[model samples]
Target: MTTTTQYPECCAKDNGDALGMNATATSPISVDGTPVAGELYTIPPRCGRAVKLKKGQVIKIINTPGSQVCDTWFFNSDDLSEFASMEHTRAFIDKIIPQPGDVLVTNQRRAIVTLLTDTSPGVHDTMIAACDLFRYSNMGITEYHDSCADNMRMALNAIGLRAREVPQPLNLWMNTPVNPDYTISWLPTVSAPGDYVEIRAERDCVAVMSACPQDIVPINGCSPKEIQFTVAG
Candidate 1:
């Protein structure tokens, strides 16, 4: 398993703010990085982890196991009606071809988070499900370490949010390959320890994430690892 350390500092801002400061918190919450055995965290094949944040507080989820997927979603606490609609955001952000630097707009038409950094530079499907025992068995993957619902669930419980609806999640560090029939294959990740994708909060949005517990295939492999959520100054 890989350990995540040596977090780089973010001293710049892109929201047209003059400070251009990093979204470090005054009292940042640090949760123990624990790995669940057979849970995929939230969704059967997808889940959402949680973390409280300020409008400009920058949150970074470091992938310790490197290639493991950190599936996530962000919602508004004010009304909860306005949230990250994946299809809408995808269409609004990228009408034709989705690229970096596009803003993930919320249902209220607010800018949630700008696609700041994409380290993988490969395919990460928002359409894939989190791992689960049922799907694992159905897919003929029955070694018993397989799970897609591990981390995202834990995050929601830890942060005191009730499970409402499972929306489309952003798959972080997961590798997907497009075949001839337009089917995407989940391949191993292209990252190692210390390599991560960072996004600054465009608004004070609540984020849910799962450090994927998928063991069905070698994507996350058998040994699941830890990650870091640092709000630095």
Candidate 2:
């Protein structure tokens, strides 16, 4: 029997659709996305969460297993259209993987967040697009699959918000290194358990983090895991 999936009302718009479900759609850190200062939260495996950070507030994301990749995005709380853009950030920082003290910029070329600390080997990816239903379909999976793109959308919907597009995420702990020939290889994360990174908000913004569920590749060690985070001034 063929079945049709019904997405949430918030996804009625053209770009707000989510191809699958996870706890991300039902769970939110807070109603308005305001996170409690210094309170730790978890984005369950294959899920995501959205948290609001005021300008100057810092968010620390922990890699509990050291093998999971967190696809993260920052959006101007006042304007969802303005979001962290990897293309613009690389131009601004002159590096593919932003290190501590580098600033992340929005598509508008405005500073959004600043990388404050990276306890890992500074191995991250700004070149890969977030996994989505189409990605899974291309891999021969006809069934619904959880995706970072969907997680980002659902996480925002849980907070009573939505974005017209799913911006390229800052894939934390994703060890896809670029070779001299400009080719990239997807490798397992090199970070140790408990490793983390901190980024300070350059402006009041909503940050969404997805515990990437790309098991088809070894980027997450072929085993997805949860991601922990905390926000503080």
Candidate 3:
């Protein structure tokens, strides 16, 4: 029997409040000066939202104020099994040496999400997973709102994936300090305002992302910032 549990994946149009944030519309972009606001969108933090995008439409996820890790995931709308796997992502995408425009393809060599832009340019850590309340207090944070954990669980359950399998989240605005020996230190914000990463999914993908509600972690340790989304029809 295919057992399904009540999980936290129904984050469609949440107005973010936990992180002192909100999502507003930015000026629409144009294809050769003809605005395609119907096809593209910019997703903000603390809330998880999904936009149905078609072929050739580009979606941009910006670290609005910069240096905030936007936790993201994507699943094949038809087959969630061949989903976004960090281990498969790292192993196949030359994790030992990732760079700009590098396609983090699936085991089938199909494009998942492209690295259109990266601000904190260096060894990006795909191994370090997303941490939550249970792990936070143990890491010295006594009290923190369970935002990251909530959104992650939501994304997993939304697509029929199990919450326990929530894997390493792709840190869109995080920068890690690399020692001479390649040891990583989850460093502070290296991203400035308006730094964005663009992606055009090759196949129909049900994508989910969270503006991490991690006040305890240094990724957004100082505070949570806002994010914006402008969708093209």
Candidate 4:
């Protein structure tokens, strides 16, 4: 577990502005000094973990081997009804690709997570939902298989929560781009090894994250792999 004595004056300046700014304009994040002595959770491929976060604490998700995506869900620790929602987040930020300074919102239009610094390309998906058995079944693979939805459920259960309360997650590193013709392409991510995205908790929130296990698509390149999670105060 890492600890930080100070944070930036603000995450982003244009909080109320609907027009999103270029992520390149944001100040470079300097978290390399955060001690790595904190809790380090290594989430296996096709699996998930549910963890509680305190306000002002930072969570770092690392793509150890690169080109992998982490499916993430956030909920208020006090009220599960208010949770991370891609639709609500997009509506609040007015951007498809969340940047370093963006504040991730919940279905209740409340702040949940603030993306402090993204070391990767900032090309994440806000339109896709977590993969599930039903999704695989619809693709002609009726067999029971590992899925993010199931992983999330199991993780949440560990924290005394139900699967039904899970919401559409913030797809970190999954690159699905909307083209000019109103079409979208699901391409493999371009993140390199050691790439990471650090986020701050807006309020006390419980989070569930899954290393996606969809082997059918090129999303994971071939199969799912392990990811690292570091929590800093």
Give the top-scoring candidate (TM-score): 2
* Winner on TM-score (1 vs 2): 2
- Superposition error at 1 for model 1 (Å): 36
Give a tens-digit lDDT track for model 4, residues 1-233. 33322312322542111111221112111121122437676777777777788898899999987878899988888787788889988989999888989998988898999999888877788888888665776666644567776677666654555534447889999988889998988788889888998999999887778889888888888678888888898
lDDT of 2 by residue, 95-210 (tens): 98999999999999999999999999889999999998878777766788899999999999999998988999999999988889989888999999999999999999999999
For all predictions, the C-alpha RMSD in Å is 13.7, 3.5, 8.4, 14.4
Q: What is the lDDT of residue 141 in candidate 4?
A: 66
Candidate maximizing lDDT? 2
Global lDDT of model 3 = 0.55
The global C-alpha lDDT for each of the candidates, from Candidate 1 onward, is: 0.54, 0.92, 0.55, 0.74
What would the per-residue lDDT of candidate 3 be over residues 1-233, giving only the tens digit for each residue?
Answer: 23332233333444221221123111112211232464444444565544444545556776777766776666665665555666677777766435677766654557776665555443345666665544555655544344554565544444344333454566666666567998877667776777766676667665556777666547776576665544332
- lDDT for position 175 in model 4: 85
Ranking of candidates on TM-score, top first:
2, 4, 3, 1
Model 1 ranges with Cα > 4 A deviation: 1-49, 95-99, 132-134, 140-150
Q: Is candidate 2 or candidate 3 better by TM-score?
A: 2
Tell me the lDDT of candidate 1: 0.54
TM-score, model 3 to reference: 0.69
